[model samples]
Target chain A: MLDYPALAALAEIIRRGSFEAAAAALNVTPSAVSQRIKGLEERMGQVLIHRGPPARGTATGLRLMQHLDQVRLLEDTLDAALRPASGPATLRLAVNADSLATWFPPAMAALPVLYDLVLDDQDHARDGLRQGQVSAAISSDPEPVPGCDVLPLGAMRYLALATPDFLARHFPGGVTEPALRAAPAVIFNHKDGLQSRWVQKATGKRLHLPGHLIPASEPFARAVELGLGWGMIPEAMAAPRLRPLLPDLPLDVPLYWHVQRAMVPALTPLTAAIRKRAAADLRP
Target chain B: MLDYPALAALAEIIRRGSFEAAAAALNVTPSAVSQRIKGLEERMGQVLIHRGPPARGTATGLRLMQHLDQVRLLEDTLDAALRPASGPATLRLAVNADSLATWFPPAMAALPVLYDLVLDDQDHARDGLRQGQVSAAISSDPEPVPGCDVLPLGAMRYLALATPDFLARHFPGGVTEPALRAAPAVIFNHKDGLQSRWVQKATGKRLHLPGHLIPASEPFARAVELGLGWGMIPEAMAAPRLRPLLPDLPLDVPLYWHVQRAMVPALTPLTAAIRKRAAADLRP
Candidate 1:
C-alpha cells in the first residue's frame, strides 16, 4: 500500500507537470514535494518519478497516480455525501449541454431539497470527479466509474427538430430518407454520434454528415431553433423551443447516473434525496 | 452521499440478508455493523434501514444500498489492478466467453506483450477485476469502474459463424436475410446482443431470436462449432474453429478496454512489457 498523503502530492505534481508548480499549487516547498516523492519511492521499493527537465512519470509512478486519481474522486464523492444539508446540498453534476439548456433546470427545480448546482458537458464532467472536483455525474455510458454506483436514470427522447421555414427551404418533400442523407444537420461536438445513429436508422447505412459541427449546447440548440439545420434535440428541451419535424418519429438515448463508490457512506442520505427527486424529474 | 464504510456494510447486510451473516463475511461483530449504521444515519440526518424481524432497507436505505453495490464493484476493480504479478509485470486478462472463444485472443496476443494468460467471458471474468482478480479487462462497455481508467480498445469484427453442417441443415440453398430471420439461432446469453446486432446488420431490422440462450462461454462456442446453430463469432476466433458463412457479409461490434484507472501508474512498465509481447502474440 502507498502512503495516502504522498500519493496525493504525487498526483498534484504529475498533474501540474513540475515540482515548482506542484509546490506553488499546494503551497508547499518544491524541496518538500521532492522529498515526499523520494520517500514514497523508497517505501515502494521502486522509483516513481523519472528525473529529467520535463519530469515525466515512471511506469510505476503513473499507475500510482492513476490510483490516486480514483482515491481523490472517491473522496470528493464522500465529501458530497458527508456534507450536512442544513442549507442546500451542493450537486456538482455533469450533464450534456443540450440536456442542461433544455430539461435539466426543471429537473433541478423539482428536487424537494435545495441544491447548489454545477453543471458541465457530460464528456468533461467525469474528469472533474477524477480530479476530486464533483460528486455525481449524468453520462451517456451505462458503465459506472470504478468506485461509483451507476443507475439507468432513463432515456432522453430526441427528435429531428427543425423550423417550419428550414423544412420548407431544404426538405420540401417531407424529409424522406434520401433527402435526410443529403441534408445539413446540427451536432453538439465533433464526436457526436447522433447523426450517424440517425443515418443508420433512416437509410439502414452508416453515413457521416459533412455539415457544421457546433460544440456549445445552448448555441447549438438556438441554431437549430433559428432553422440553421435539422438536428436532434432532447424532446423535453425541444418541447418549448422547437417541434419535432415528424411528430410521430422520435429518437431515444439512454442516460446513466454514476456516483462515487467510497462515497457510499455519506451518500446514503444524499442518494435517497436525489433518487426521489430523479424519479419525479427524469422521464421513464 | 452516504457513509462509505456504513453503506458498504449495509450492502453486505442486504446481500447476506442478516447482520450476523454480514458480520461474519466482513469478519466484524454484528454489534459493530449495527453501530456503524447508527453512526451513518446520524451523520446523514435520515433513517436508512428499517430494523425489525428481518432487517430491511428503507426506500432511502435501498437507494443507498444500490449506491454501495456500485462502490463495491469499483473496489473490486481496484483490487484487480493492484494484484501482484508472479513473474513479469504483464497482466492476465479474462474476456467474455464469446470474445475469448472467438476473436479476442488474437487481439490480446496481437498486443505488444506476452501476458500471463487467462481468458474468460465478459460476464464472468470481469468479476476477477472486482475481487482483486486480474490487472486489466476487455469489457463490452466503454465505462470504467470508479477507480479505473477506460480506453477505446477498438471494435471486434464479428461474422456469422457456423459449421458447414449447421448452415446446410438450416439454409440448404445458402443463407439469406429471410432464412436467417426464420432459422433457429444460437445466443451466448439471454442478454447477449450479438444476435440482435447481426439481425440488424443482415436485414436492417432488429428482431429477437427465438432459439437457445446458452449462458456458458466455452459450450456456447462449441455449440456453434459443432453445427448447433448460426451465431456471430469474433472474426479472429472464428478463423480456426469455423469458417464465415458469408465471407462478404458485414457484422461487427465494438470492443472496449476498462482498466483500473489506478493501474495507469503501472501502465508505463506494464504497457511496455505487454506491448513487447503483444507484438509477437496478438493478431492485428
Candidate 2:
C-alpha cells in the first residue's frame, strides 16, 4: 500500500507549483515535505517530481495525484451521505472561457463545492478528461473518453460580429472573402477554431486571417467592440453594440458535459444545474 | 541570409499550433509548408519543432521566433518612418491579469500594433521576457531581465474582502488565526501569493488556507463576491457590495514595465501610454 500522506504531499506540490508553497498549504515544514517525497520515491522505486524552482509532476506523479483525487472525492461523497454536514468537496473541472463568461456561472453557483476551473477553448476541453487532468469537462466534442459519461448540454450560438465603425472601415464593399482575408480578426487563442470555422461556413472557402490574439473571453469580445477585429462571439455575450458580419450564418457549437462515471452519484446536482442554465442560455 | 521565409513558417506553426493551421494562415499548401520546415531543419542541423497534432516549439525554435519578431518590429518601424502606410506590426507581450482587467487596455489601444498577449501572475510575468517568449512584460518585480529596461508603473493596492454574510458565518469571532484556518479563501492560481502575503502581513503567521482557485481576474473577484470564499482583491475591482476583513491592512504590490532595450525605440508610444494610464489607476 502507498503512503496516503506522502501522496497528499505530492498532489499539493503539483497544485501549488513549489515545495515551499505546498508546505505552506499543507501546514508542514518544507524539509518534512521533501523528506516525505524522498521516502515515497524510494518506496515506489521511481522519481515522481521534477524539482524545479517551480516544481512539476512527472507522468507517474500526475497519475498518482489523479488517483488520490478520485479516492478523496469518493470518500467525501460517502461522508456527506452519512453525516449530511460534511465539508464541501473540491472539484477540478475543465470549462471553456466563453461558458465561464456567459451561462456557466449559475451552474457553478448551484454546486456546494470549491471549484478549481481550468479554462480551455471548447473544442479542446475534452483533452483535459483524456489526460486525466480534470474530473469533468465542458467540451464541444460529444464523444466521451473511456470511463466517462457524456451529456448533451445544448449548443452555444456564435455570430460573426464587428463594431459599426470596423464594418464601415474594413468591409465597405460588404462582407466578402477578400474583405475577410484583408481585415484583422480577434482570435481567442491558437486552440480556438471558431473564427476559421465561421469563415468557412459563411464564405465556403478557407482564408488566411491577420488578427490580434486576445485569450480571455471578455477581452476578445471587447477587442471586436474596440475595432481591433471581427470575431465569432458567443450569442450570450454578443452585445447589441456589435453588428454581425454575416447575420444569416450563425455557428452553433454543440457542447457536452463529460464526467467520470463514478463521479455521477456525487455530481448529479451539478449536472441538473448545468442542464437548467444551458437550457435557458443555449439555442436548441 | 538564414531563410527568413522558413523562419516565418516556423513562427506561424508555433503560433497556430498545427502544421495545417499554419499552412492556412500562411496561405500555403501543407506539403509546401512541410518542405520549408524540412529544408530549414536540414540547414540548421537541429530539430525546431515537436510535430504533435498540436505542434510545439523546441527551445531553439522559440529563440528563432523571438529573433524574427524583433526583426519584424524594427523593420515595421523603419518602413513607417519612410512611407507611413505600412501594415500594423504584431507585438507579443506578457501582462498580469489584474492590470489587463483595469489599467492596461488603454495603453494597448494607444499603440498601433496587433497584440498577442500572454497572461501570467504579476510575480511571474517577467519570466516571459527572461525566456524570450515576449518582447515586453508587465511585472510586479522591479528588477529587469538582462538586456531589458524596467520602468516602475506604481502599485496595485489589495484589500482582504468578503461578503457580509461570509464574514458573519466564517469569522464570528473576527479574523483570528483559527478562524482564518477554518475559513476558505479564493485564490487566483498557483502563482498567486497575494492571499498568503496579506495573511502574513495581517497576522505575522503562515496559515494553511483552504480555497477555490479561479484563474481569471474577473472570475476570481466574482468568486469572492459570490461568497465562494474571501480573497485579496485589487482595490480597483473591490466592489462596494463587499466589505474588507481588515480595512487598514491593505497590500500594495508595485508593478514595473520591462521591455527589451533594443525594442525600446519602437515601444516609446506604448510606454508613454502605460505611464499615463498607470498614473490614473495605480496607487503611488
Candidate 3:
C-alpha cells in the first residue's frame, strides 16, 4: 500500500554498506540509488541514511526497515493463501549456534518450510528479529516485543565439571578465586557469561583467565572434555562426563521463543511444533 | 576493467539467494538484475547462474566472483597507497573459530589493519580465500593456492581427555570402541573430523555416539570438562585438565597461512607480525 519501491531502495543502501555497492547490486546508477533514498526521506520527513563511506541506516530508517520486513512477511503469507501452490514458504529464523548444533535442528526438521537459519549468540538472537533480519527468534528474553508473541521454552542446564587431572593440576587445594584466576579456561565467546556468572556466584570473584574461546556449542563442549579447563555445561550433555569442579552447579538458563504476532497459518503449526519439541528436550 | 560491475551483480545474486532480494539489496529492478546476468553470460560465453527458487552461481560464476573479489582487494590497496591518511585498511581474513577465540586476536591486534574476521572450521578456511571472500586465510592446508603464497604456522596439538569420574564411570573396564560408542562425546560440528579421525585411527572403527555438539571451541572444552564426554582439545588448554583417554594419542594438527600473491608491501608487516606471534604461540 505504501511506497514499497522507495522503502526497498533505502533498505538496500544500508544492507549493501554503500551507495556505490548498492547501485551495482540494484543494476542502477549511484545517482538513481541516491535519488530513490532521498525521495523516500522527503516523503517520510526524516533522514534515512548516514551517508558515510560505509553507509548506515538512521534510527528512522531502521524502524522503516523493520516495518518493511514485517510487511513482506505478511505479503508472503497473503500470497501463499491467494495462490497455495505458488511455492514453498521461506521461513527465516535466528537462533543460537549451540541450539543449531544440538536440539534445534530436530525442532526445525519437524516444520515444512524453506528455512533460512541465522546463528548468533543467545543474547543477540532477538536482535536479528528486531532488526527485520529474521521473522521468528528464540532467545533468553521472556519480554516480548510490543506486537510479537512470546512463549516460555524452559531452561538449559549447565554444570561445572573438569577432568581429574585438570582439577588436580589447576586447583590442587580446592576451587579458590586464585585458582580460578590463574587457571587457563575455555569461553564460548566474549559475549558468553555462563562461566563468568557461575564463577561470581561460587567464588565471589570476577574471573577472566587466559582461556581458549570456541564460539560454537559442540566444540566448546569438546574443548572442555579435552580438559581445557573447568566450565559450565548442559546437564544432559555432561551426564556421561560429569566430574564436578564445584559441589553443585546446574546453571539453569531459561529460554524463550518469540514470533511475529501476525503470521500465516503455517506459523501456527511451526509454533506448536517448536513448543512441543522444546518442552520435550529442555529441562522444564 | 573486466566487467567488474556485471561480475559483482552475478555474485550478489548468488549471495543474496533470490532475484528479488538481490534486486532489493542492489537498489535495482529485478529486470535489471536479470539483464546484467544475461549480458555477463553472453559476454563470457558461459552460464554463470543456476536459476532456481533460490539461485546459485555456476562454476564460472563462482570463479568470476573470486576474480572480482581479487580486483577489489587490489583496488583497496591502491587506494590506501594513494591516500595514506585514510582510515586503517579493513582486512578481511578467514580463520578457524578456535584461533579467533585464542591466538588470532593478539596477532591481529599487533597489526594496523582493521580486521574483518571470518570464522570457519580450520579445514574450510581456505575455501573463502579461494572464493575471494577473504583477503587471506589461515588453514591446515600446506598446499598453496595457484597464486597465493603459503606459510607454515606449525602444528596445534590436541590431547584427548575426560574427567576422572567420567573416565571411571563410562570406561570402568577400559576405553574401547564399544565404550566410546556408548559414552557421550562432544564434537564441534558435522564438518569437524578431529574426533572422528582420532576414533577411527585408535579403534579401527567408525563412531556416531549420542554425542553433544558444542560448536564453539571454548564451549566444547567446557562441555568436555563438565564430563559430557571425552574430546580432543588443544594441548596448551588441556595441560592442566589432562586425563587422557589414550595415553599416546595427542592429535597433532599442522597449520598454514595463505595470502594473496599480489599483496606484499602491505602484507609484509602483517606476515612478519603473524609469523613472530604464531611462532611464539603455536606448538612446534
Candidate number with greatest TM-score: 2
lDDT of 3 by residue, B51-128 (tens): 974587786786676566545545556654574342233455778876655565555535444344557765456666
What is the model-wide C-alpha lDDT for candidate 2? 0.84
**Span of 10 residues, lowest total lDDT, candidate 2 chain B:** B79-88
Which parts of model 2 are misplaced by more than 4 Å? A79-88, A122-124, B79-87, B122-124
Error of 2 at B25 (Å): 2.5
For model 3, the stretches where C-alpha displacement exceeds 4 angstroms are A8-35, A45-59, A79-92, A109-118, A121-134, A200-210, A236-242, A263-266, B1-284
Docking class of 3: incorrect
As for candidate 2, its interface RMSD to one decimal place is 1.7
lDDT of 3 by residue, A1-284 (tens): 66876776675565545787567545688898888888888988989889875588886786676566556545565644574332233455667665655555656535434344556765455666565556678777777765567889888778888778788888898988778866756666545677878887887765544445455565456556766556777776674654888876668888878886765344777778778878887889
Model 2, B142-202: lDDT tens digits are: 8879989999999999999999999999998899998888788998877777898898898
Model 1, A1-284: lDDT tens per residue? 66876876675565445777567545678898889998999889988776654466676776676565445434454466674322222234555555444444434433222222333455456664565445567677776666578878677777888777778876788757657655567765434668668767766775544343444454355557756567887765564656666667777777776776655554566556546655665667
Candidate 2 chain A: worst-modelled 10 consecutive residues by lDDT: A79-88
lDDT per residue for candidate 1 within B1-284, as digits (tens), equals: 65677886775565344687567546688999999988988987888776753466665675565454344433434565673331111244545544444333333323322233334456544555555345567676655565656655445667788877667776777766657755656665334667767767766775534344444444345456656567776655563767666678756555556665545554445444434433443433
Q: State which candidate has the highest lDDT.
A: 2
Q: Considering only chain B, report the TM-score of each candidate against the true chain B.
A: 0.56, 0.94, 0.73
How far in Å is the alpha carbon of B81 misplaced in model 3? Answer: 46
